[model samples]
Target: MVRQDIPLPDGPVRTCIGCRRRAAKRELLRVTVGPDRDGRQTVVPDPASSAPGRGAHLHPTRECYDLAVRRKAFTRALRLTGGPSSAPVGDYLDSRHDDDRPHLATD
Candidate 1:
């Protein structure tokens, strides 16, 4: 195999599936579909963005999550055959919302 030493972009940017806003990669949370303990495919959060397969980015907030769900972004973004539940994402966001710290997305 051959490799080329090409210059890379200065910084990375990703768009939020919820807000549809482009922001720095670090500012968004990467989520990808994965199997739950039951072996069923489910939407899971990838805060570290290390998960395999296609992934979608979104701000970690309720409003964004809601918008994403309403618009069925997860289904299209992840390209799933059947609609996947947002429970995992909701639970993840809810857990973060319970925190007493500032968040990237407000409302």
Candidate 2:
């Protein structure tokens, strides 16, 4: 008898609102919109990608983040009440830009 090795099936893919590319879900970060304790709009990271409210996916690149902010992609994707406005999500992304740690290449 001979044993054979087979690669496992690739997981589901998600479209990045920033780069407009289809990539594996794991390679993208999920952002969700919710209300704070005072009911004010708030955006948060959805690490598990299973948040209940509206969600959008973004690549980790700074360029992608800028594109999304410029085009208001997040607001549209999440059907936000208002158009693109720098809020919690934007602030979070901005912080990531200053991160000195190197990112692992997905390709």
The most accurate candidate by lDDT is 1
Query: Please, what are the lDDT tens digits per residue for candidate 1 over residues 1-107?
Result: 42356433359978899999777888888999988888888999999999889999999888999999999999999999888877998999988877857668776
Q: Record all residue pairs in model 2 with backbone atoms less than 3 Å apart, i.e. clashing.
A: none
Number of the top candidate by TM-score?
1
Clashing pairs in 1: none
Clashes of 1: 0
**Number of colliding residue pairs in each model:** 0, 0
* Deviation from truth (RMSD, Å), model 2: 9.2
lDDT of 1 at 51: 85
- lDDT, residue 10, model 2: 84
Worst 10 contiguous positions by lDDT, candidate 1: 1-10
Model 1: runs farther than 4 Å from truth? Answer: 1-10, 101-107
lDDT of 2 by residue, 1-107 (tens): 52355332389778899989877889988988876667777666676778896788888677887898888788788888775443666666677776766788999
